[model samples]
Target: MEKIGTIASIKKEATIYKLTNPFRWFAKFGATGGLILFFISIVALVWANSPYQNVYEDFKNINLTFSIGSFVISKGLILWINDALMAIFFFVVGLEIKREFLVGELSDIRKASFPIVAAIGGMLVPALIYYLFNQEGDLRNGWGIPMATDIAFALGFLALLGSRVPTSLKIFLTALAIVDDIGAVIVIGLFYTETIHLIPIVCAGCIFVSMIFGNRLGIRTPWFYLIFGIFLWIAFLKSGIHATVSGVLAAFTIPSKSLVDGHLFVKEGKSLLNEFEVSFSKTKTIKHSQNSLTTKQESIVATMETACEYILPPLYRLEHSILPWVTFVIMPIFALANAGITIEGDLFRSLSHSVSYGVIGGLFLGKPIGVFLFSFIAVKLGISKLPEQTNWTQIIGIGFFAGVGFTMSIFVASLAFLDSNSLLTNSKIGILIGSLLSLTVGMIVLRFQKQK
Candidate 1:
């Protein structure tokens, strides 16, 4: 009896520790993802500028095709990465957005206001700055380029700062980035879309409505959403709506409610676990050389697994399963695909272009100014308050961090300048330069500041 009680207590403690120590887990994930992305980007850049530039181009232009009966889908490697894989990325973003609005930092109006307003400022000011520099021509379409905040990269930098960064500030930056994501999604859907096909749009609408119906019907299985979500992506893909938008829409349909209550789960889990423990002694008596569990013990374990699944909401489960893939695999592949740009002669001369200037100026100069200015005004106007244990300088640092708009900026650039390779190359150059500057300056600002 005493041994059983001790083992159970130890298990409970282990579970509590895991739940309470998410920061370390998240920090490792962010830093690893960021490093992988950075390394991949560097590799792509080197590969593009080397004598093998032709090889790099060939790699990106590699055509892939999938067909079924009368239906066919074909695209170059880069387009598939940007259009198809990114939709999965956007789906994860959508899940985070929904969770934030439902229960995370954005759940409370007062808590959400600071980051929300700051995000608006961060997005608008950079875009306006980009537009100002490109106001003369088609370059204005690229305004969306600098308005993104790469959360993975930003959080990775923050993780490097370690103990210097306060938890409140981390929360502030994360919330701000999530809001920035929402803005990006809206802008992409509204402004960046190409010509629309009504039949596909109607099909997408019908599918989306069915997804909502499924949610209302209390369907908690993730496979249901996953299957329908693929169809939704296909519909949006055919609708000319930049298929990634479907990711976000499908995310909103995932069931956020868990099937089992927390209390009931704990009760059942303890019972099953205790039963398994008792069966352990019996397994020892009938021991196989492989150390396999007895049938009764296996059944108890299976029931426990089911209970664990029931206790977690599908949205969380999906996010947990998919986020690691997005971070480590999809995003790094994206960086590899899109971060390469051939630079000829003088780099400064390349930067001299008005389009390049717009991107650099918008990201480096405008992002910090916008974030700080808007937040300051909100504080002064009593619309929002600064995060606790944080100061003005830290907010400025965060604003600069927001300027590290790598992944999404590159994604938007691909769309904005799809027709012109020269323009696209120039934009990629600006993105790389601007993001580097943001990362460095943000580090300097936050690194030197003392916590209050």
Candidate 2:
């Protein structure tokens, strides 16, 4: 009995030991962000539906503007969150996409095949289902609404599945979401755009050209891209293109190459160290107080700082710097701004409308069905395979989770039903219903899944 208890205690400690600090930190980060976002959504829902709804509406209506002489730009707070902050979010997305194409999962065609096909299935089927109901009306423009998957919500929800879900499953979902984002960007650009202003577009083209030229010239200063990016964003904003798309375009212009080679850096570093040692030895005899580093040491330190700067690529560094801000701050704000669908008398009655039914049915039924069917065919055709340790049941469950379209769906909804309050409200209702159903379905399925 003592031996068995001792072994059990050791095993428990071993399990605890395996949960590394970095993993724990990341887990907390994702969980906290997701929870805050969920909490804020609930707050928005309650506030929007309560007697204090006027306050919420007025807050959203608050205006912010920029101008120079006759040139002026003004927008509501909600629009700033949606149009401007979301652009920064898309910029990070662009960086991820570029990295994937260059070195991540999408770099290799074989590795990329499964997620790409799955994403295509996830997108097409939802849109088709939506189009089936919305055809021959202004609401037909909303086909794009059902197509985007909110990866943050999906991944965060996936994390709640705990150890029952394999890590590879999360990786596959992330890749699929990235591919899905690419599709969504294309849809927004081609379909959701307004009347074009050619001069601003021409100016945007010139800026983009200059950016590419700067990259070719090996001008790696971050400020150059930042300045040109501002111009590109403003031009796109004025050109009737969605300003967020400019963020993605700007990410493409960021330098991904390292400035100094390891060998050269090491050689110079060793030389600097030798000089530092000699200078330190010379200064040792004359040293009075340990106030700070000597002049030679400061020069070497500055040189070391520059070397460190050249070692890390700007694109990835920027991505890493902004990811937490986007995830925790911007995402929660977006939820607070957009997720406030007023739950008035008979919420289900509004959802019974065609647009509502389309979004609900497409997400709940079409997303899983399409994802599974397409993946099945892809595997059968020998073009793609299931992620390691993930089975068909888990895939089906994840497909349902992918149907939880909130952020991107609402953004598209805003574009689709800009002038139609009733349609927009109905669409939001569907989003709520579909997302809830999807979450319920996925969680139930995953929980009931047999463990190995």
Candidate 3:
């Protein structure tokens, strides 16, 4: 009894340590991605300004082709990254969005109200601010550019504040960002695009139906979705709606529920373990010889694999495996491919442009006001109460943090402008300036609050 108690105490201490440092693991994820982005940005800046500038330009301009019989898909490297690979990114984003809505922060109406209302205000106010300044012709279409929060950068910044920021505050920000991402997706699908073709649209619809059926049928393997999702992506790309929209659609069709619940999983798992032990005991192993283990070992291994299959949720598995790849490889490559903006004489002229001003102002000014005001109103009306241990000052600081719109803002900027060069430069300038200002102000304010 004494030994068992000591063992249990040791296990409890280990569990506590793991729980306390949960953010450390996630922080490393965000940090690695940020580092990759930083290095890529540096390389791009150098390459764009170097004697090899034309090489860089020509590389991006290089036409890539994909053809199936009479249907040929051709685009520049930049477009491929923005339209194709970024679709996978959006698909992952969609998965996160769905999970949050179904079971995470946005699951309960009262719990969701603060972030949902804040996200709405955050999106609407920035868009309105952008539209007010850029109401000229095609520039009016760029209003969505400022309405996004870059979760990676924002979370990374929050993590840097250590325990000064409450855990509840971080949760609030994360939830708000997730809601903000949903709004961005809707805005992109609805407002940002042009004509849509019916044939491809029908094809996409059919694929979606098939995916739904797969979910209903308890199909667990990822291969079916991957193959069909590629086809759906192509169909959507051809349909003239952005290919990235297909990612969101595909993610929506993925089954969030496990085939077996946790209670059943544990019961079945223990049964499988007992069976495996029985099988192993039947085959007496002499010096751990492979021949001694025989067919029983193989059977036990298979049973263990089956048990794992039943126990692990597909959504959890997918998120765990793909998250590292998406953050480090895909996103960094995207930044490298897109972040290069050749600074020229007309750079100042581009800065003076309505699109540039709209993006900068919307992110810098609109995000905080929108987030705070909406949150305050929601709490006041009793739709949602503030997170426990979080004050208004912390909320305002988080609002500022929300304005650090790097990833999604750049993505929207790419879609918003027709002329790539002007868009790229303006977006880089705006993201740099707005993100810097938001970070500086948020940090200073939070520090002041802590001191007080």
| TM-scores, one per candidate | 0.92, 0.88, 0.88
What lDDT does candidate 1 reach at residue 398? 94
Q: Each candidate: RMSD to true structure? A: 5.3, 7.5, 6.1
Query: Which candidate model has the greater lDDT, 1 or 3?
Result: 1
- Name the regions of candidate 2 deviating beyond 4 angstroms: 1-28, 262-297, 448-452
Could you tell me the lDDT of residue 421 within candidate 2? 78
Candidate 3 achieves a global lDDT of 0.82
lDDT string, candidate 3, 1-452, tens digits = 76688789899989998897876665465455655666787798789888999999998888999989998989999889889889988888888888888889889998888889988998899889988987776767678888999887788767767777777888998999989888888888888778889999999899989998998898878998899999999999988788899998898887787666788878877887787788666655434543355576677778768777777767767877887788878888787777677777776686787777778888888988899998899889988899888888888888888898877888888887756566557767777677778878987877667622
**Model 2 pairs whose backbones collide:** none
Off by over 4 Å in 1: 1-29, 281-290
Candidate 2 lDDT over residue span 75-182, tens digit each: 999988988999899999999999999889999999899989998999999999999998977889889888888888888878877887788888888898899899
**What Cα-based lDDT does every candidate model obtain?**
0.91, 0.87, 0.82
Best by TM-score: 1
Angstrom error of the Cα, residue 262, model 3: value is 2.0
